[model samples]
Target: MGQDETVSNTALEPAVPQAEASRRRLTIEVVIVLGLSLGQSAVYSILRIIERMTRNVPLSQQTSTLNQSATPDRPWLDLTYQLVNIIFPLFAVLLVLYLLQLTHPRPWRMIGFDLRRPGFDAWFGLVIAAAIGVPGLGLYLGARALGFNTQVQAAALADNWWTVPVLILAAAENAILEEVIMIGYLYTRLRQLSWRWPMIILGSALIRGSYHLYQGFGGFVGNLIMGAVFGLVYLRWKRVAPLVVAHTLLDVVSFVGYTLVAPHVSWL
Candidate 1:
């Protein structure tokens, strides 16, 4: 080969190993971050499903409750616990944002978490919510009827003055944590490591499903589909803001709506 070509090849030699090392490092980072957050929840959720399956009663006869009061008898202590539960998990979201900020000057805006286009985000969020929520409710009912799912109680907190507010905060927390980490952070990291769109979407969906397994098969299936849809939406718009908004809306409706309506509806 010519001298110039030989030198060019030698100059590029270090890049290959460097790139591979970077990929390895990113892989490890992804594992650790996930382990410290939703990945941990996914493990417990799997165990929860196993425990439910081994019970004497059918899955549909069992219950999976969220937002339960830590101290049901003491309103003040329960409120404290509720706030703690909603606030603490969000540290993971901050951690991911910090990590992203190291590489991105405007990490929040990069992931579509900012309010640059509030109207667009809101419009799309409502559309996505309607698209997912209605069918999701039907899916839940069908799954329960078919004995593939446990009865899911989205809220079990006492009817204190703070109940609705706390539920709203919890819903927002869920949206921020899940969409930020699962789609915004996870998808970005995977794409950086040269993952294909399909693989990234599927992996995120599976993890989402795994974490929701505590609610039973129906929860898993419902969330898996939700994850895929959200992943695609993120891919399409390069934004997670709408996803956060939609998820918050869905959970708010589930938690607060259930707390208000479940008492009057026998089937709920």
Candidate 2:
């Protein structure tokens, strides 16, 4: 055959997806991927918390301050800071998307995200949110009261023109970053490694729990439950939109609503 004919045949050959392109062990990939992401927080916080527990320190002594938006005197600067904070996590999302694109021709679809089912996703997400959010609130309150977890300052920002909007955006950013990374990306990657569903779900849930270690033992348990439930939901429905929506709703209420309700709710 002529050179051009040979080149044409080569080009026509089917592409080998990254999922099937390797026979490497899943354990190695797990370490590498997580080590680069939430693993840092998990490792550090776990060790720190362990040390604290050994010393018999109070849970309140180890607290995580969240959603503390600054109130700058200058409007333009405040707006700029707020916008940057809200949009920063999109970079992480984009990075995940880029990595997936290397392996998946249609990365979004492979991630089980369906834009066409916005209403369906939203409603289902609301259901999931309600299911998790109510119990989660009780868990937090009880954890705080019992001193298993730290007192979570959900909203530390004084109300400003951009405070509420920033908090909303931050919530959305977290929902997207976490759900996409944990449920969608981890699921796809684990499947590529030929892991079973139960193992994969547990691994995902554990990582999710670990990331919240800084919040204390209760944070780990609470997020662990959330992660497992979310993993199960994805396994059943193969839909990610609902998880994102549910997470967004939960954070929004937790961050914004806490400020308004903390006064009336003595326990909070």
State the C-alpha lDDT per candidate: 0.94, 0.80
lDDT of 1 by residue, 1-268 (tens): 8765555556666556777888898899899999999999999999999999999999999999999989989999999988888889999999999988876888898999998999999999999999999999999999999999999999999879999999999999999999999999999899999999999999999999999999989999999999999999998999899999999999999999999899899776
State the lDDT at 116 in candidate 1. Answer: 92
Worst 10 residues of 2 by lDDT: 18-27
- The estimated TM-scores of all candidates read 0.93, 0.83
Q: Once superposed on the true structure, which residue ranges of model 1 sit more than 4 Å away at CA? A: 1-16
Model 2 C-alpha lDDT per residue in residues 25-49, reported as the tens digit of each score: 4446656656766666578878867
Those runs of model 2 whose alpha carbons end farther than 4 Å from true positions after fitting are 1-21, 25-32, 51-57, 70-78
**Clashing pairs in model 1, backbone N/Cα/C closer than 3 A:** none
